[model samples]
Target: MADFRTVPFLPTAFHDDATLDLDGQAALAATVAAAGVDGVNVLGLTTGEVTSLRVEEIGDVVAATRRGAAGLPVGVGLGPPGAGTLALARAAAAAGADLLVAPVPAGSDPLAPLGEVAELGLPLWLHHHPAVTGARRSGDELAALATEIGAAVVVVEEAPPGDLLAVLAGGASAGVGGLAALFLPEEVEAGAVGTVAGCAVPERLVEVVARYRAEDAGAAWDAYLELLPWLRLEVGSPGLRVRKEAWRQRGVLSSGRVREGAPLAAASKLAITRRLRQVGADVSAPYPGS
Candidate 1:
């Protein structure tokens, strides 16, 4: 399986008018790569805005990310199930995505689609987030699917530490969301391979993982604590508005514009900025509507 330690779920870049910003997405991808993350996953809930983008647009984003990734492995999330999903998978592969990230389909055996996706020739990372997909499977079932489909990794969310450990023990590479930053130390100790997070602070996430790998548990814990507040603020948020705002403040993105119906409140922006500053982030960059 491909190693995916410290993968940051990137946010799609947009102009002040919320139009797709291909160049901006490339720039963000470059920035994340420069920050030393192990890999980058585009078109996921936070980054690619998968639901809103068409297949061609997703291909554009994948190609843009490929350009900015400095040759790092780029993974693209497979959007909703449909005829387009396979086409998008092919497009992503042609655009240089090294792997596929997708949730197991709701209400049916996931093997068929998963097997077909694996046939695309890129390693598949099965996403197991029940809240979003509204589908739940036992560890054995998930492992069976992974084993059957030859999945390279499984991204899980809202699973207890024991459950997460159990998934890993089942002989499948596992990545966790939710309390990833908080549980990272223990998870890493227990052999969890990676984490899919929207912490907006790639450097810190990279540092924590690096510290743990270096056997510096003390420093890793400190870094995790510093990032805890930001993670708390991000989890359960409606969209990537706060994360995009942080990126804008730090000059990683041109604007924090989100699609319609995912607006970022002014109060929320101010609060995010305050929290970022408290953690010593540089937020002096110019932003839209300034």
Candidate 2:
């Protein structure tokens, strides 16, 4: 595991749905860095839709974000077969990505992709999504990987509470840096280096990270609890569809319509609106103090 103390896990921002048209992507990236967040992650599960974007489009998004970030470290999310991951990593590197994140395919050697990209010498963030990756690596497995690499392997962003806690315990034991949970603010307080749920609300996400850094655990926890309903409403509901819609309502994205499989339903929209109001989220505005 990479040194968690050294690499702070920042929220991974999503691309705009149809509502924002094409400009939402660059805008979101700037919005994140302008807030003083440590870094911005592109091509995330929430944005870029991994398998959906063409290689060129991926590179375009990375470049646009790099320009918008000005100086913030831009991370590129790489997924799938090692070869594909290597290609994306190289492109991100060319586009000035500060870091790279990839999921180690299950059943296959987790070390394979790591080895492929090891030569790049860029900071690496590994994903620990058991559901997507299929197999889970024990703390011992992760520690051994880090030991073998000699390069920093940052935090593991695992999902679900049970898996996240287990990974955290394992990562702590392995001395691999820190662990990241999906969007569970409570677990973040317990010592989840940072989170990767930037799709729902970028400003709020920055606030959560700031609160965590300031050691305002109580306020951080409260902020997370306040938004828990909205967070839950977003999980696996509809690809980029709902996310784009949420961002649109917040005035961050131009619109909320996503690709084919990501259509939003009326009921889901109502649920999202209810949760946002319940949390006192200013859907009519973007960011804090705006």
Candidate 3:
């Protein structure tokens, strides 16, 4: 069995833009890698809407994410399956992706697809976003899938923070989501291998996890509590935009524009700014959303 106790999944950070024109993508990837996050999952619905990125563009993003991650794992998000999924997986392998993060399909057989990926020898990280895919899997389902596929290198991201513990208590591989920042200590205490969150503040996460493991749960939870409002602000309909803007505001990235339908309105920006201040984010200028 693969030990995931120390794994930390990171969301790929990029400029808020319609399409990353190679240069933009590369720059953002480097920024996240330099920020010292553990691993990165790219071309997923979180960075930008997956549907908006062209197949070729997806390859470009993978290449860029690889560059950004440097020696760390650059996990690519494989999709709804069919030709597109296969094509992306092949491209990701060719471009040097370290792992493939994906949602388990409802109708398809995970064993076959996982076997195909295993033939390529790429690690698989399971991502569960019930809201987007409308396909939900329990911890038992995830564990069964992982065990059947011999995928010890696994990642699980579910929404509605409260439910994650139930899944972890049931023994999934890793608990991954923005909620991880808030609930990781409890999940870890309850036997989660590791966690992934979309807060774009890997340093903070690393610190909190270190503190928690050091038996300083109070300090860990305190840090998490301080950052919860920030997480809520950076997520939701325009999470990518808010997150990139926060990164840019902190000098991590250049832009904060996401693709169509991810607009950062004035009210939204103000809300993010207020939340950041409430959480005591240190910066000269207000976050981009503000």
Candidate 4:
């Protein structure tokens, strides 16, 4: 479980016209994975903007994600077992995905989707997020699902503390999300094996985790603090564009276009330059998005 490091969902990069940038996706993966994340989510309905992509485009994302992750474990998020969902699972499996992140489907049997995709034979990850689905599961329920799917990792987001304890007590390897995960040091101290974070700049996430483990709490807090300005951009809304802009600032992505989400204000993009500079990232290089 200690080996489970911080895993950020790779934000989908796009052309200004909103078409997927396959090369940018790969570059995002390779750069962040190299920065020290143990794993990455390359096919999230939110982070990857899968909701706005064509079914065939998802396969492209799977391939690009695989290329970027190299040999590291790759996680793919699936909603439910439908024709579209199954297609995604097949693509992710073919791409050699090591983990499947799932949420309990609404208006259907909670675990039925996992059972339907059981043939995929991938390790499961329970992403307990109620914000997206408006339904939350107990830790016991999550543990049972993990047992059913033979899951190796569990993620708790927007859930109660006791539920997390329940899952941990069930002998599940638990990862932290929500605000707790925002501060890696606190989450690590509270028994999180890993984190579910955005992949705008993984080196900062890595630094915080490394410092905390090295018993340098001050440095860890300082590192986490420096990232606060950027992270705050996503507080009240989906800041996918903001994150992409940061990647642009880091010289990794070409554009920060979103399919349907809120566009990042130009003022915020300028502020990102200062944020990137605080982390010592060379922001001089310009990307097309910049």
Candidate 5:
């Protein structure tokens, strides 16, 4: 099973015309791999825009991420909710995914779908994000599901500090999704295996994990604090447009254009760029289109 302790769900980059920019996506993956993340997750809420992508697109993204990861373990978030989940799982596996991530299927019996996904023979990373999936499972329920499906990891989204601590205390190798980097030290101290942020500045996030693992609590806290403003901005935004823009400012992506949306205001872009620079992100280049 792939170690998901410090996985970063990558943001999918797009050209100004809204087509998937595969090269940009590859560069983003390669950047994270170079930064020393434990693994990479694609096609997730902030990264893949899973619900908006077609089945074939999902496969393409997975394949592209695999290529860019350069042998780092790659996990694919199963795209969208549908009867086609099994097919999607197969596509992801075929495209070289080392792990499959998905929410418990919505139904009278979520376990049945969970079983179906487990049958695909890849390690599972069960996602519990009530805000997105509209389903909440107790910690005991999650542990039981892990046991049943043999999940390698569990992603708890929007988890408060206490809830995250509780999950770790239960001995589940859990990761937090969304803007909770401040909790990284506490979570690591409480036994969190990793964190999953869709931040554009992956190197900083990676440093946060590395410092903590190196037992440099002060350094880790400082690194996480440096990322707090960006994380707060991300959590408050609706989608990954800001993140893509941030990457564009860093020259990791060709452009920040999200599919079917106006570009962020020039002032907002400038502000984000300045904030990123203040936090020591490598934003030496000018923002695209500035």
Candidate 6:
């Protein structure tokens, strides 16, 4: 059972050629760990780009993440029980993942497909995203389902990610992505354990969580507020290049290229520069065309 506090929803790092950058992947995990994350998750939100990965590639990514995790727990997102779900789960576990994020089908029994994944012997993170799945479970329902399936945590995707309703329902809860940052205070007040956001620099978020949990909510708000500009730069269709670019500029990644090939907007590029400068981040100068 992994109890996370500031888990980062990591992106798959890639080289300029769009191949998996194992070193970059490791560095991303290391960077997040340095920020003091309780755990780190990749591939849960990765379904958007899931079609781009082969089974072996997924395994490789998990192994690379494990290498850089500094002994912290790691989690991977798994989809509905496809013929390959078990294989993917085994790969993730063999590669060092301690848990699986299982997305429940919408408007149906959330536990319908979980038995197979639980069989992998890794704890499960039940993901309930009504917006994506079209079946919204109330807080009580989420809490009940988690209890029924013995979920280590219930990941709710909703505004505030804290999801007051779910928290009030009485289960351990976590939220994901940029939206979690938007109303962290509300999320915290609502009793969210921590958030799962994927970003190049996670120290800022770690600080916010630490500050908030320590009861200096005003300081937490200040830390989270400073990240508003950077967090909002979800550029490109399905959006992630800006973050990859941030990693590149910081020397953590070689390039910001993603599988989708959507060019980073010119304005986003400028915004990344401004925000990085504001944080006094040391960006690597002079990429090939810049």
Query: In order, what lDDT does every prediction score?
Result: 0.74, 0.58, 0.62, 0.69, 0.74, 0.70
CA lDDT, candidate 2, residue 218: 82
Stronger candidate by TM-score (1 vs 3): 1
- Looking at candidate 1, what is the lDDT of residue 56? 75
lDDT (tens digit, per residue) of candidate 2 on 84-147: 7888888878888887876656774667777777679887766555556575776556655666
Better of 3 and 5 by lDDT: 5
Model 2 compared with the native: what TM-score?
A: 0.78
Error of 4 at 142 (Å): 1.6
Give the lDDT of residue 156 in candidate 2.
52
Per-residue CA lDDT of model 1 for 185-263, tens digit only, reads: 6666555677777567777778777877777789878988888787667665554777788888888788888765567
Residue-level lDDT of model 3, residues 186-208, one tens digit each, is 55655565666656565666666
| Candidate structures ordered by TM-score, highest first | 1, 5, 6, 4, 3, 2
Prediction 3 TM-score vs. true: 0.82
lDDT of 6 by residue, 215-241 (tens): 787887888778766666643344467
Worst 10 residues of 3 by lDDT: 1-10
TM-score of each: 0.90, 0.78, 0.82, 0.87, 0.90, 0.88
State the lDDT of candidate 5 residue by residue for 1-290, as single tens digits: 12326787887767888788888888889998888888889887545777666777777888788878889999888754567777778888888889899775555677777788899889888877676676777767777777778886777775564465466454644545444354566566655667776777777787777777777788878888878887766555544777778888788888888775567887778778777877788885665554
Residue 137 Cα positional deviation in candidate 2, in Å, after optimal superposition: 1.0
Candidate ordering by lDDT (highest first): 1, 5, 6, 4, 3, 2
Candidate 2, residue 68: CA error in Å?
2.1
User: Relative to the unseen true structure, what is the C-alpha lDDT of residue 95 in candidate 2, on a scale of 0 to 100?
Assistant: 80
